[model samples]
Target: MTSDPQQDWQRWHERRTAQVSAPHGPLSLTGTYWLADHPDGHIPGVPGVWREEGDAVVLTATTEDGITVDGKPLTGDVRLGADHTPIPESRVATGDRRLVVLRREGLWAVRDFDPEAPTRHVFTGIEATPYDPRWVLPGTFRPYEEPHSVRVENADGRERGLGLSGELAFMLEGAEHTLQVAVEADGSLWAVFADATSGHGSYRFRFLRPAAPAADGSVTVDFNRALLPPCAFAAHFICPLPPPGNTLPFAVAAGERNVLAG
Candidate 1:
């Protein structure tokens, strides 16, 4: 890889903007309907009858409903598991809108992603700070004796378990800082965090993803790539909030500030 941080950051920023503005991206999400809320299987503006059955969602539609399954017209009931594919490839669709099934902590929900959503059309771009070498610092990852989960409020006002596998420690302005991090399946480290800038100069909270630690537990804690949570782009996403100890006491004047005003 090239050693030019500025060039790399510009490419990353461009890719991030393209991804966010793409059809079926976070901006396209319109609604997240929990199956339990509508026991009668009649979603407010959705055309199909949807109900939870065992571990799958059963959707029933008629030809008049004009719903499609795997690109074919859906005329009868079909059992669908949670969609693991991208939004555009979701199994169910109504016109240009994709219907995505989601299961979280045993609760099932359906998401509507429309390519022509108003939010997607109105998106200007993400507002991010220029790459600064000062924000990139050496860090150490210390794994916990045992992974744990903490209860935290989600963007949707629900409390759920947020899992943590370790802590990333680094120094900023001669002060030591730490953030609880989750170990992803790909060996990356994910952190949900907030700082003094949060809810003030920046979004309420942001996400940090660092590469997996080295064999010696050394890592680079780069704040220049801080990300706006998915909820920042759409109101329907249920992103988790920062955990108790992940809030930094000082302002972090780096990374993404917010989505550009439309």
Candidate 2:
């Protein structure tokens, strides 16, 4: 560790603070209305009546509903597929609030994000400890003999299957720890993990994604960029739990620690 990691850490911390407090950041989320919970298609404060019909959502709206579809007042009915784009590009909107249609395990839900939300108003910043290069260590990616899925409980207490593509192993303290990771579409790694500090200092769990590994399975297992999941910002999101044995026994004091006042 260098003598003045504070300067670099300050810069990184400032960036994180700006990100979480941004116009449509995590704190902007106000509600998550699951279609399963409302079979009749009425989600309070949200315009349009929605129903899950097969693989798509059947939305019925009148101009009086005060709903905007594709930036124009909507009337009549429309079928909407899953919203996979960023929140800004979602098909539904009401002023600054982005209504995103979601599909998970065939179950549909809608997420509402508003810049004027109370959480966003009270958001300080993400509390993160300084970055230390020593915490960023080289690692090895070992692909699973075969990809597998495990039934894990989500933040909303729903058990759903979480797909695991491979495992990344690295030495944190003295013992080697392995984290089940997913290979994203861009070939990068994605991991959800917890440490001793979880539930005590920061979110109950955080996310980490070291850069893509080499062909030979060499990679950097940097924990300095660990992130809080969306569920940490709002209770409506159904974020999956860590896979079996994904938790580290040691306290990881790096990366984003808590939500601070920006």
Candidate 3:
């Protein structure tokens, strides 16, 4: 971390804008078709027969359907696993659209990322507040004996398990506060939270990803970098809502507020 937090924030904000407006970015997502919802194997607006078979998704298409697998035109059935690669490098694509296979909690789905999506074209930029030093606070992470999952409503109105690994405690306005956080594979901490400003001055909810804590459990809880979740850009996303007690009583007037409109 550099001593000039404003410069660092400006760079982060620029990178975030570029990424979200990219060809295959969240704004470009047109749909997330769950195979279980389409029993007949036909996904709306997507040309292919998709079915879940054990651990892989079976996609049957023809060259006439204009679908390609691994950059080659497809003419037969191809089993695909969850796409972990970047959207541009997905194994399935058709023209300028990428079909990303997704698996979560034993259910399978496919996301359609079209470069020509209307949302991507109309996106102006993100509405973010300028860096403020007050939003940066000292915090601590207290890990649990064993991680647990909590059922939370998603942006798509579905319920899903939100795994929680610990709590991040910090002080603001002379009061102590805490939020339930999940431990990422990379040792970072993630939180889905909201505040008084949410749905008023900012998006409905936001995400906070803090770096790994030190041996003493000390970390920086910087609201200056709070982010608008993917759902803020596209309705197809199923971002999890804030869990119980994750909502702060006060307003947070920092970080990315919303997607700028044209």
Candidate 4:
């Protein structure tokens, strides 16, 4: 732990604000075009003809389309897999707009990120409570014997498989609560959760990512560091909602509340 936890939180919050307000951040996301929905390979606003192949998306475009791949003008066909780089550095670009190829649950989709998106322009800041020591609680992570998947409804109103790795148990306001969590590749824990404040005082749902647990499974569950999900910044994000049992019964008046717009 830092000697000055409040100062550390202030720095973290500032960094998060800069990240979300970046040119190609979540606020700049304009749309997610599922390839299956547009069989003709033509998405309404996105250039190029996109068709899903065995494991890649074949993009057919011409000089008139003004699409570039890896900084070179693409005049023919190019096969692209899911983009793993930052949106601004994605392989496909039509001017300042990035066309990110994404594959989820064997379904192919394209995300359009435009720096000039209206949502980005209107984003003022994130509404967050000041760092409070009381919001920091000791927690424990219990890994499942085997990981499991649950079908959860996403912000886009689509059902998708949400992978769960374990349970994160913590205490709040004299009550014990547990949330289903997903373990990241680096061993950190991520959770999607909501409280009584959701939709009224905060966003509908928020994300909490605790650092890797200790050898004894001890960790810090800091609500002061809670984050508004991507869907809070843009409607196009398909952020999964809080799963059953993940919602807390009491209000959590900490962390990020919502996005402030002009």
How high is each candidate's TM-score?
Answer: 0.97, 0.93, 0.98, 0.98
RMSD in Å for model 3? 0.9
Assess candidate 2 and give its TM-score to the true structure.
0.93
lDDT of 1 by residue, 142-258 (tens): 999999999999999999999999999999888889999999999999999999999998999999999999999999998999999999999899999999999999888889889
Model 2 local distance difference test score: 0.84
Q: Distance from true position, residue 86, model 3, in Å?
A: 1.2
Q: How many pairs of residues in model 2 come into backbone collision?
A: 4
Candidate 1 contains a number of clashing pairs equal to 0
Each prediction's whole-model lDDT (CA):
0.94, 0.84, 0.95, 0.95
Lowest lDDT 10-residue stretch of candidate 2: 1-10
| Per-residue lDDT of model 4, residues 1-262, tens digit only | 4799999999999999999999999999999999999999999989999999999999999999999999999998999999999888899999999999999999999999999999999999999999999999999999999999999999999999999999999987677899999999999999999999999989989999999999999999999999999999999989999988999998889999999999
Candidate 3 residue runs with Cα over 4 Å from true position: none
Give the TM-score comparing model 1 with the true structure, all chains together.
Answer: 0.97
Candidate 1 off by > 4 Å: none
Ranking by lDDT: 3, 4, 1, 2
**Residue 97 lDDT, candidate 3, scale 0-100:** 95
Instruction: Report clash pairs, candidate 4.
Output: none
